[model samples]
Target: MQRSKLVSQILEKKNYLCVGLDTDTEKLPAHLKNKPDGIFEFNKRIIDATLEHCVSYKINTAFYESMGTKGWEIMQETFNYIPDSHFKIADAKRGDIGNTSHQYAIAFYETLKADAVTVAPYMGEDSIKPFLSYKDKWAIVLGLTSNAGSKDFQQLILSDTGKPLYETVLETVAKWGNIDNTMFVTGATKADFFEDIRSVVPEHFLLVPGVGAQGGSLSEVSKKGANKDIGLLINASRAIIYASGGEDFDLAASEAAKEICNEMKGYIV
Candidate 1:
């Protein structure tokens, strides 16, 4: 989907919520465990239930990849099942040498047809450029993440520039692609850094994880991270999808998602 369409969806729905489909069979309700295609079934219900309240869905490939071929098939089916109006994301942090990155790009962009894919930028421009070559697709680069380990490298000050590595990453990468095509992954846990981050890439969208289950504050993120276009896709996974362990999992999931969406609406102009 084009960036304009995504912005319109956010405005029209009065939401910037991205539901993470990190479906785990072991954690699924016991009732669904015995059912055939439980993974897809759970995802279908989650999609159907929360579609109205969310603007995007992020599928973390690891959950599906662990299940092997069956998981891969369900992942494709779930991707296809999502409505075109809602943005679909492949939360596969893929980045490698240029040639390998090319195949990875084709796998997610062409074969699976995801609107966006999470990419690790450790390999530099060659690894990232291949994904950017595709039209209307996005490479959500890992910037300052929410993980505790981010302190090891991303927060380190650069030798010459003296700015943090993550800050440099945002400044340097912003020149490679315009805001419409390239986005940065700034974890919600790093809410305090949003001010500095905005100073660099003020217009580009940010895919923010670490909310909900991770205990990141929504209001803090909205205040620090939002741009004039409401440029933030706040994602919630275990908090919403696994809201309940009973048969009413879908309903509970929808309720959890709606609550976040409502909170998000307050952030929107």
Candidate 2:
């Protein structure tokens, strides 16, 4: 999906909510725990229930990968079930040497056909350049993440530039790919820094993942992070996906998604 189309969807739906599909069998309702395709079944219902309220769906590849081959099959099935109008994301956090990155790019871009994939930029330009080569696909680079350990590296001041590691990353990588194909992951927990991060890369979109279960404030994030295009994809996973542990899980998920979407609508331009 082109960036314009994504923007349009957000505006048309009055929401920029991205539902995270971090499906885990252990967390599945007891009724589905013994089902043959529990993961896919859970995802299908979540998609069906919340598709109208959300503009995107993010599938954390690790959850599926841990289940091995069967997990992969279900992941593909879940991917196929999502409507084409909604953006599909593979939260793979893949980054490696150029050659390996090329295969990773093909896996998510060609094989799984995800609209975007989260990428770790620690490997430098070569690790990310391959993913940018594809058309209408995005590389969502890790930036000021909400994790407690982000301060270890991303917050360190550069020796010469006097800017934080993430600031330098935003400046350097923005040159390699334009707004349409490149985006940064700025955790909603870092709401205060949104203004600072936006100062460096004001126009590019941000995939924010620290809301709901992580306690990231939506109002603060939107107030400081939004741009002329309202370039923010706020993701909520556990809070929405596991909103209930009973048979009404899908209904609960939909309700939770609607609550966030309604909140997001107020921030929409």
Candidate 3:
């Protein structure tokens, strides 16, 4: 999606929520658990329920990949099911040697038809460049993640720059691709760092996960992370989709999303 289009959606919707379809077999409602297409059916209902309340959907590849061949089909089907009006993200977190990365890019952007794919930048620019080669596609490189493990490397101080490693990453990675083709994945749990992150890459978009179930503060993230375009995509997975486990699951999910969307209205403008 073009940056203008994404920004327009945010402005029009007055929210930046990105519903994550991290659909797990263990979490499937009892009625759908034994069905052949249980996972996809659950996903369809979730999408149908929450489509009006979000601007994007993130399909975490791990859940589907764990299911083997059948999972890939479901992932593709889910991607195809999302309306073109909303941005589609493949939260795969893939990066490697240039050629291998190129194939991964093709797998998501061309085959699966995703608007963006999350990537690991620890390997350097070559690992990310392949994803940027596609028009209107995004390489959402990891900056400062939300997990407890992020402190292991991302927060380490650099000897020469007198800055955290992720700060250097934000400075350096921002140069590889212009704002149009690049974005950063800064976990919403790391809300305190948003002001500084904005200082490094003020014009680029940010794919912010770790809200809701992960307990990240949406108000703080929105207050500091938003640029003139409101460059943020706040993701919520289990908190919304699994809002209920019974037959009312779809309505419950819709209500959960509506609550978040309403909360977001107070932050955007």
Candidate 4:
């Protein structure tokens, strides 16, 4: 999807929620465990339940890939199942040498047909360039991530630039790709850094995780990170998908999503 259509969806729905489908077969409801296609069944219900409240769906590929061929098949099925109106993301933090990254790009963008894929920028521009070559697709580069390990590198102050490494990544990458086909992953846990980040790439979209289950603040993210276009796709996974483990799981999930969407309504405007 183009940036215009993505921004349009956010405005039209009064939401910028991205529901993460990190569905684990082991954690599925008791009734679904014995079903023939339980993974897809669970995802279908969650998607149906929350579609009205979200603009994007992020599938963490590891959960599906662990199940082997069956998992891969269902992953594609789930991707194909999402409505064209919603942005589809493969939350696969993949980055490698130039040739390998090209194949990885083809796998997610061409074969699986995801609108965006999360990529680590550790390998620098060569690792990310192939993904950006595709039209209307996005390379969501890892920037200021939320995990504890981020402190090791991303937060370290650079002597030359007099800024943290993550800020340099954002500023340097802005020159590599425009807002239309490039975005950065700015974790909600790093909400305090949003002001500095905005000064670097004011127009780029940010795929923010760490809310809900991760205890990141929604209000803070909005106050500090949101651009004039509301350039943030805040994600909620376990808190919504696993809202309840009973037959009413879908209803609970819907309620969780609606609650977040309602909260987002105030921020979008």
TM-score of 3: 0.99
State in Å the error of residue 37, model 3: 0.8
User: lDDT of candidate 1 vs native?
Assistant: 0.93
lDDT of 2 at 173: 92
lDDT of each model, Cα atoms only?
0.93, 0.94, 0.93, 0.94
Worst 10 residues of 3 by lDDT: 169-178
| Candidate 3 residue spans exceeding 4 A from truth | none
TM-scores of all predicted structures: 0.99, 0.99, 0.99, 0.98
Q: Clashes in each model (backbone N, CA, C under 3 Å)?
A: 0, 0, 0, 0
lDDT of 2: 0.94
Q: Which residue window of length 10 is worst by lDDT in model 2?
A: 260-269
